[model samples]
Target: MGIFLPNLLVIGGVLILPWVLMLFNYAWWRPKRLERALKKQGIHGPPYKLLSGNIIDEFRALKASHAKPMGLSHHILPRVAPFHLQTVKNYGKTSVTWFGTDPRVNIMDPELIREVLSNKFGHFTKPPPTSLLKQLVTGLVTHEGKKWAKHRRIINPAFHVEKLKRMLPAFSTSCNELVSKWEQWVGSEESRELDVWPDLQALTADVISRAGFGSSYKEGKRIFQLLTEQSELIMQAVQTAFIPGYEFLPTKGNLRRREIVREVKAILKSMIEKREKAMKTGEADNDDLLGLLMESNFKESQEQGNSNSMNIEDVIEECRLFYFAGQETTSSLLTWTMIVLSMHPSWQVQAREEVLQVFGENKPDIDGLSHLKIVTMILYEVLRLYPPAIFLTRCTYKRMQLGGINLPVGVQLALPVLLIHHDPELWGEDADEFKPERFSGGVSKATKNQVSFFPFGWGPRICIGQNFAMIESKLALAMILQRFSFELSPSYVHAPYTVVTLRPEYGAQLILHKL
Candidate 1:
């Protein structure tokens, strides 16, 4: 018996040794293999380093470029670290870079991007494992396959034209409050140069709270604050995600992110629970997004004959997503639109004129917003110049052919929307310039018969809230124009950087003048 026991122990040790080595190889050696494969395909960039890869180099470049002031020329692109515009320029349109062990294929071709986003299920899908940040607010944005289809189908009605019309009152109420607040501030003898970014962010948050959640802004404000903090931490994590187990460490940023996530989830849970209780008691009379979602989800549950339809947790995640996705995109749209209008006062005047011509001094209705052609054109132009999401990423789970290249499983692709939007080949030499006239006739005419512009992305998975965002933006812009005229303040800096969305690093400071 003793001899048999010794033999068993020896065999177990031998088996475990290989498994440990294999784990080590997967964590440390696989990335090198990917880098070699990319190199063999004639793809090149900064050479990959151990673990950190090119992350340090990327950050260094971003820091140096950000230190300099932005130039007026459209050619002077925004500064970003680790992955600068220079790298894109140097590597050609379809270059490959190593994000840790993963080989990221950067595709800037508009036609190819259209193919990928359109046929998402066929060629590729959302990354196999979304990061923790994604897990916190996973809904339509992160869902893929059948789940995504179902969610998309169910949520589509919430943003329908009729539903948006219902939500317009909420939008107007929020915008009116913003206008009234600004008017009060402007009435003082001393002129105030305000950072409209934060104000716009707050207004959008309030609007989403009342319109989407049917809740007060007080709770929504807290969620926004948590989301902003989470955004910063997620950016940092993304920069280092290539490193194995980086998120597990108790670093200051990671710890804070975890705490914020907890806080956000807790708050959302309480709100959802309260709303559910109200619904059960037949006291909830709201027709807002929260109410709509609950009603829709209840119907789905009945059809499936499942008691556990969309539970508190599911509602919480969706609500968190509502605030994060809904608020952020509209806020970005408004901020960049304001900046563009400041740059081209003539276009700004044209948009205001169109707004007045259509709606006069009356609050903008759904029909009136739809008819604001000039304002729509200007907004489209701003989106083209500064899209909210600079790039879209996907990972291949099986061997596939893309752009005639044989791609293996685990290869990541980055569809850089910003580069594609500004590509001379697609939009011509004047592509980089802000010309609202391009979109004067609508997106089809604006592209000059090409499918080049994709600010809200392309194909089946285009942003669900595109119409909602456009309506919200048109309403807010119309209200602002009705009440005030503004220009970029001297202290304003043109530093656009990507945290979650491309945003002015300092703030969008504008000198507001009462009309």
Candidate 2:
């Protein structure tokens, strides 16, 4: 009996001890070590707590800040990123914070940010998406190394300027539908109080649906509906992300997420298969995004063989990214543009005048859209004030030196776009004010060649669809300016918050006066 018991104990120790040690390292030793490393470099932040780390503190701060809408103000760092702001204020611009034992160094300096994002030496890499995040999004955005290069190569041709020019009709079609719908709602009424937030979302979604899948929003409405639900569920799941294996359990949320992913993939797979068949039979048009991507894929496959190209599933993920990223960027920009323009009537007037002069009550053609410099300036300024993405994150997989600090492996880098945008040092004393003229001379002249104004990110890894987004925003804004003048409604609450992308909490209720 003693012999048997001792053997059982030995087996148990052999099987379980490694996992226990790993847990200890992850929960305690690693965090403490990283903390000491940062402290030694004269960078410090809120002391890390075990397991949950700073997540609980971040949650509490965000919850309290988001309890109610703020007044009409562009100083939204306090409302949107209270914890990060507090951390920076308490520690310094170059500070540290914990996201579940993972030390995230807040690098707000543009020079340092440039180095990290440029990744010239390939020292910094995007933090691997969590399983929950993977469920929500994956594709070129998530990949690294050869796989990323391959996907980017295949995807590049799809977003090239020439291809985007071809997609202009799709953008025009979507914008025309939206403004026409609004004109109908306004009817004979002098002005109409309308919440443009949801409507704008629908507009962008419809745009991506057409441009991406060569179909109307109604044709692929189910995919978007599933994605929206998945996004909400994923946001809730993010709260419990630090709890290891929490998403793997058969919890209701987890199960539903799984179901949503399955359905979404199924729908995309069917669409892709049909498209592939149509292309093979020469019946499909090669103008939309999907056609371009597939054509690019085929070209790559022909040159390097099938092994180098993305599979059907990879194609599906890219389509998903197109919908999410493409839709979110333009919609957020448009929504904020409406709200900000309403707040600053003079700039709105200037923008409308410029739009009127450029297009003169005509449908915005590509040439005229590009010539609307005032509208472009307004969009750039709005992006600076309320960037669709509040922050960009990356991680170190190997020990590396960033500026003067030695970044330990596994250290996460947070480039707080919102803070940098609103910094007095970066943008002057009137940084928070709505001044579109700051961008009148173009992005280069505005920032004096500094890597400061990157609403769509900076460097080679910058968003591929930035041009697509700017063009779409310009066309839509020009159309709206041609038709109606708008101002915030009495019921409108000025609360800009982040939900993947920064959005209005209480909705953008604006009174649209027919011009």
Query: Could you tell me every candidate's TM-score relative to the true structure?
Result: 0.93, 0.98
lDDT per residue, candidate 2, 12-115, as tens digits? 99999999999999999999999999999999999999888899999899999999668899999989999999999999999999989899999887788888
Instruction: List where candidate 1 sits over 4 angstroms from the true fold.
Output: 1-16, 76-78, 81-84, 188-191, 307-309, 448-450
Residue pairs clashing in model 2 are: none
What is the Cα-based lDDT of residue 66 in candidate 2? 90
For 396-509, candidate 1 gives per-residue lDDT tens digits of 888888777777778889887787788778888998799988886788876765557888877888888888899899999999999889998999888888787888889999
Minimal lDDT window, size 10, model 1: 73-82
**TM-score of candidate 1 on Cα atoms, chains taken together:** 0.93
- In model 2, the Cα lDDT at residue 322 comes to 88
After aligning candidate 2 to the native by TM-score, how far in Å is the CA of 191 from where it should be?
Answer: 1.1
